[model samples]
Target: MLDRLDQLQLRQLRSALPRMLEPVMKPNHPTPEVMMASFLQAVDKTNKDIASFQEAHLRLQADGVFPRARASQKNSKGLKHWRASEHPDWANPDRKRSQIS
Candidate 1:
């Protein structure tokens, strides 16, 4: 969603958002930047945590919930198009050492 915005638009939104949200904000409440950062972090985790993601999907499937088909989905197929991958050296240094042994 944020990918569409240019730097100026993003700056404008960031500057305007605080004033807009101030009316209902509590004294100890998080700023929009912190909230958005946390939200984006969570969203990034959903894409990176394969084992946890698959486990959650398996549980959902057992409950008769299924993901929608991607055939009609028009977004870029980056990681979704991948079938397999090797771990980077930094990502699995212990396994790399074991393989050498």
Candidate 2:
């Protein structure tokens, strides 16, 4: 039947799709400094936008345009913790260590 043939073709397509898409995820090389700088710039821009939005929301509340404060999206990654003494190797780039380390 035509319906049976369609199901067979769909199964074959599903099996082939993973192989066809595998190369898309290959990692590209990028420097840590470049990534960090770009991330900082993005965070700065987001902070500015959030500040402006908060000011506008406050104005609207004062003018009785909205009854309550608006809820903003919460950051899931709460905070970062870094200790200098914890990873001495990171501080001393000259120190040689195993490749896995």
**Which candidate number has the best TM-score?**
2
The stretch of ten residues in a row with the least summed lDDT in candidate 2 is 67-76
- TM per prediction: 0.23, 0.36
Q: Per-residue lDDT tens digits of candidate 2, residues 43-75?
A: 565556555555655665676544332221234
TM-score of model number 1: 0.23
What C-alpha lDDT, on a 0 to 100 scale, does residue 92 get in candidate 1? 75
Report, for all candidates in order, the number of backbone clashes: 0, 0
Instruction: Give lDDT tens digits, candidate 1, residues 7-100.
Output: 5544544455454444435455368677666556654544444444445556656654333434435555654553335424546778879988
Question: Candidate 1 — what's its lDDT?
Answer: 0.51
Off by over 4 Å in 2: 1-29, 67-101
lDDT of 2 at 72: 19
